[model samples]
Target: MATPSSPFSFLGDLFNTIGERLQPPDWAVHEIQNRAVLFLNHVLQQEPEAQQRLLRQQGRVVRFQWRFVTMELVATPAGLLDLAPAGSVPELTLTVTDDSPFDIARAALRGDKPAVQIIGDVQLAAEVNWLVDHVRWDVEDDLARVIGDVPAHTLGNAVRRVVGALRQFVGSRTAGKAGGSAVGPAGNAE
Candidate 1:
């Protein structure tokens, strides 16, 4: 008889095979990175303190690495970030140390920071850390700009409730997986 995990394992392997066969083109990757930079700058613009910090570090480049992917961004004089020119050296580099995507996603869902190794400028590192810790995307406000305040608020509340339920479910599953027993909402183990 097939185990409960067999289907998931097969799906994972299938996805990996597909991913290996279909690598995104360079232009597609570059466009995606540019979009990410634009989104990041939009969020940064909403936070004056974060913008000021970036302004102070203007012209400094930060490189982020996760597995095979790398992104290089430089702080601009306007207190925004832009993709660093190809072949430009970064002043600082941060490499994600955790190898498992599942573990990284779990940590993110738990509001925990993923492990990373930082190399180079300490001041720049500190500023970046501060930004990570304090700055948040104002998703509801952005939604309100499109859908109006009341609908945005309703949607935000709905999202929060769903996220809360998901967190609880994931937490329970994690605990159960670690303990070798299913955990219930009331904290009972079976």
Candidate 2:
């Protein structure tokens, strides 16, 4: 797992099942690519460069001579994957990954979400941040709806797993902070 957790069995079992379901089948790679790429292409309509590249691929992949232009919708052993464009992960500039589709969806559903915000001392790039800021979490529902057509229902399950895992993470953090003062800073005081 990319993130670690205590032995408590909050979401581990659920996420494990979701991961299993998310792996594209041996013959389903093409379908998976079509679905994922098309959604991304639609979302990226504002970005002409990426949209052009995506259109050329028929919602699968297109390899241009330049490394920057070639993208592979590869289903490697590490689950469904996409070789995104260089600027795809603009949020990496902050090195914080607290955001997730589930979080965005819940926040927006509750009507307290903002379109954009600054963090620390960094100014997120205007274009990329603008894209992020404009992307509504309802789009997440759209993605999930599209994935519903797939035989495996991978994205749907993954979203559920993510929400469950996040709940577990919050519970763990709360339990640790609320109960650990009695044990002092370290787990033990030799």
Leading candidate by lDDT:
1
Error of 2 at 3 (Å): 24
lDDT of 2 at 7: 46
1-190: candidate 1 lDDT, tens digit per residue:
6535645456656766776688789999999999999999999999999999999999999999986678999999999999999898888999998765666777887777999999999989999999999999999999999999999999999999988887887787877778887766787754
- In model 1, the runs with Cα more than 4 Å from the true position are 1-16, 183-190
Q: How far is candidate 1 from the true structure (C-alpha RMSD, Å)?
A: 3.2
Q: What are the RMSD figures for all models against the true structure?
A: 3.2, 12.9
The number of the candidate with the highest TM-score is 1
For each candidate, give its TM-score against the true structure.
0.86, 0.30
Worst 10 residues of 2 by lDDT: 61-70
Residue-wise C-alpha lDDT for candidate 2, range 8-119, written one tens digit per residue: 3445456556655676564575565467666654556545544333333332322211111223442123222254443342222222232333444544443434334333
